[model samples]
Target: MIPPGPKAEKLAEEARTRMLNEVDERRDPHTNATVGQLLDRYMKTLDVGRSTHGMYAKYLEKHVRPFVGRLKAGALDGETLDSLYAELRRCRIHCTDRRGVDHRTPRPDECDERCRSHVCMGLSSTTIRHIHFILRGVYEKGVRWRWVARNPVFDVDAPRAAKPDPRPPTAAEAVRIVDAAWEDPDWACSYGSR
Candidate 1:
């Protein structure tokens, strides 16, 4: 068999060196990917219901992405996660509520009396808990991927939501309400109720 020429030999040697460098780069301990990288991988691996995946993506973008998306996965400690959680709560409280028939934006002063009473226009505990849950799930995924040492959510306590009061109407109150409803001329007369 004829021997390879000098030009061919030089090209082959260069290609081999490039491949070895790539392998070494992949093996290097110092070249770890970032949290964002892992999140992308996690998103791809998700086999959840479509609605759930959409919800997760929304929370990730709104709450987690801006703060720690670029951070090294292994470097995100409990403190950082805790701070992010707090910020999310704050954001939810201050978020603008623009939905209504008139489409008019209500000023803080025009908000319901309850909303105007707090230092930081407060959110319901349930909403705060939901934000916490989202963060907890993301961190749990990090743990599974060996990115975080542990899920910080385990250490932090989620806000306690108040139970809805059970206030069934009394017999007398129910009778009064039904009578008033029957007396309403608009519907009652239309329905032939005297």
Candidate 2:
């Protein structure tokens, strides 16, 4: 029964296609999976250098997992992610504003009075950007897998990249360095301009 226009026909067809896709998505268990599960699955399939892979795993474990690990992938929104980032910025360890010993020893028996009290240190913007990178990739994969229709991360703003802050040696320190270099002919030879 009919819409005579081409545009009308196209719109009707798109609606029908979307309805069918929704039905299929409803039956897929991945649609209900949590972000943590998605991250774990993504890691298993990620292909990268050993060191990069290790760093990604470490970032996920230490940052993302502790906060929103239990949240459903489809349910996440930009606000939730923003909150997570804010908390991380406040304290990397998510400290309760209480003092605790920052233990260097794995075994408490090995711990001594020398262990210093923990200080809250927020992650740098660059490190936070790395976290954003990991989540963006993961959510993109989730979209492809139909776990989510859209990546929530697209709505969030990543922290700005940090600029390098360099400090040149003081004149006194530079003089000391020159003095030491000339003390040995071999050191002087090694200090030549490239």
Q: Estimate the TM-score of every prediction.
A: 0.52, 0.72
lDDT of 2 by residue, 128-176 (tens): 9999989999999888877777888999999998888999999999999
As a whole number from 0 to 100, the lDDT of residue 21 in candidate 1 is: 88
How would you encode candidate 1's per-residue C-alpha lDDT over 1-194 as one tens digit per residue? 22578688778888888868866755323436676776677788878899988977876766677888898866776687677766766654334454323212445355544443324344467766775786677667866665565566777778787799999999999999878878787877776754
Q: Name model 1 segments beyond 4 Å from true.
A: 1-31, 93-123, 173-194
Question: Scored by Cα lDDT, where does model 1 land?
Answer: 0.68
TM-score of 1: 0.52
Name the candidate that leads on lDDT.
Answer: 2
Listed per model in order, the count of residue pairs whose N, CA or C atoms clash below 3 Å is: 0, 0
